[model samples]
Target: MAFPLQRGLTPQEIEFLSEMEMVTVIPRQRLEGLELLSGPTEKLLPPQRATLPLWLAILLKRQRRVNIVPPHWLHPECLQVILQFETETKEYTDTFSPPPQLPGQRRAGDDSRRQSAAPLRPKYTLDGQRYYPTPPFLPQNTALTPSEASDLEREIALPYHWLEVGNMLLDAASDDLTEPDQVRRLLKDLREVRMSKMRKRVDALDAAAVAGGGVSLTGVGAMEIGEMRGFVAGVVEGLRKIGASREQARREQLAEEGSIQGYTQDDDDMQF
Candidate 1:
């Protein structure tokens, strides 16, 4: 499907965006890591645990030089507890209310609460592993524009919903799977199931949109619908392309095998 207007950043763009988020790390061995060659001649050294940008940390971790310290929100125990509660509770309601203020009045408690509520990083569970979602870029050094700050706040706030977070956590952690590989498989299955549901929903919406009418979902805007439709369509198309490519490869391999078998049979006949 051709998407005319620019909607949202692609997954690759999102990964590039999240590269600047700071993540905690503990060095496993003494090593000379990547140096900041341009700005400063500094390198991450071992024995001193430090917080570094996600991109740098990922590089070091891949090299087995550092161990990543996942944030508190990603803790399995905490996620599990949240998941259990979610399964038990039918409805969730927020109890905390914003502190009232008069004109020209600023309360310290209100400021603190606002700061606490508006977390810098938003957590999302993927394959039983929780991570903060990101967009194209969050400049580490430069000051954030008002728009950037608001975008960050919205991203952080969206995933903080108790019900959705809990459900995602539960989906990641399969009840019977203990082994890492098994749990990963379970998470993959769960993700596929969710994606299928989304695809079906999108199809329904697209059908409605095609049938001389359109439908509205609560909290979802027109722009969002277009973006989601594009995303889902992209995913489905990519999957189809991959499947076709694999099937073609399989067919060629089988044909070659058959040719070899026929050659062997002719050789045996000649010998007879």
Candidate 2:
């Protein structure tokens, strides 16, 4: 039986797929995990039902690659699984106090004094590869042009919605499973999720604007799309590096000027 061969993945996604393509059977543990983190799919029509198992079998063509799971794998039932799970996670997290900081850790205040005094090694490791952001990912000291910075924002924002959906899906599935309901339940649940996300985003954007953060895509972060939080973290780390570098450079230049002026005055006063 023939399934529609959709367009091939983009070069970026293809590269990601290549690295992560060692597809193994969804382990029993993961399957059981999925049972909690993902809701059971609604029975598909004959053609629709056959796609996943088929895609799953064919997807194993690569042996030594890191497998990339597209965010949409939990589609059709997306609204039910992704959005509900996110909403629940946030509500649960808010009730808990934040974790305590460990001793010997430099707080932000102490760190400022030492920051420019030390060079930062902005290397991060993911799946064993040293991830230094060259263009979009920002990694550490990679300088970003204004356009490149804008591009980073675009790339990060693109994945936000998809991540939100995937996270919510995983969360919904994590709970104990009950008997499957009708398709309407899926649509209704999803609609509710979409609505909630919109409301949250609006509130966030408004707050960001009021706080002078420029255009803030607030709740759109780890709160909505739970799955891609790691990706978001990566982008954030990159931005942090960019900000730190600029600030460090500014402070260093100012300190150097102060030292130079002080020395010149002492030399003149001392006589020659």
Candidate 3:
């Protein structure tokens, strides 16, 4: 399938949108003015289902006002299946690069493609031996955390260095040959490693900025000016891919209104 363009929103913007993405929720109690107020989607009364922003739903859930419906993918069984597949399967160099189709199956985006639970079979080469890789974890429509949503967007749209890093992280987890009970533990470790790596990169950038008197990373130790330029060029290229335009006016508006506390009613209408 053709992926959507990656441009427009910055990472920060996407995070904000994820928090604002609406989900269908069931209210446990009646809240005043709920039905009258318009949100990202149609408003309804309790104990009825309503579409509310994730942030709001989370807040209400904490207050015992609503129960957020867990997306299908987040189900324990589903997660277990995915984790099992990723663990048992050898890490492939490429998942998106023209995956192999099973007999009686059609290419991706083909009108004849069969809708079946059978997984997409991709081939992997190991020790000069060619083998059909295990079935991949098929993604589905599911509510996701801001981080998960961001990663998904990058996975399908950005397809950058981070994607390779993610795959390698999963591979590392599988290498331990841990039992099923340890899946969550390994995943937690993977997340910590990923976060630490990101933190170091941010720290490095910050240090470079400070050393350069906030002007540029130029003449900062072993860091090359060309590398900094290339980093920026990559960002611009990604933005261009998604047909993103610079919304300087909105950014300026946000800057002027410092420390905004909440989303507006209209903002709740955004879908994940």
Q: Which candidate should be chosen as best, given TM-score against the real structure?
A: 1
lDDT tens string, model 3, 140-252? 22244466555532221111122222222234322322343454454454334333433334434434433553332211211122223446556445644444334566676
- lDDT for 9 (candidate 3): 46
Error of 1 at 65 (Å): 1.8
10 residues in a row with least lDDT, candidate 2 = 29-38
**lDDT per residue (tens digit) for residues 1-272 in model 1:** 97785556553444454455555566777655445521232245665666666567667666677766543333344334333332344442111112112223344645543543333554545456765543212222222235654563321111212222223223432231234343344334433433443455555544553365644343221223343667766765665677688889999999999999999999999998
Please report, in order, the local distance difference test score of every candidate based on alpha carbons: 0.44, 0.35, 0.41
Ranked candidates, highest TM-score first: 1, 3, 2
- The CA-based lDDT of model 2 is what? 0.35
Say which prediction, candidate 1 or candidate 2, comes out ahead on TM-score: 1
User: 1-272, model 2: which lDDT tens digit per residue?
Assistant: 99874343333453332222111222121111112111232222322211122123133223311122222223344335444454576752222111112222343555454432223335556456664322112121112335644552211111222333333223333121122243335535544554455444444443453465843333342233333334444554666677688889999999999999999999999996
Clashing pairs in 1: 17-136, 17-137
TM-score of every prediction relative to native: 0.38, 0.25, 0.35
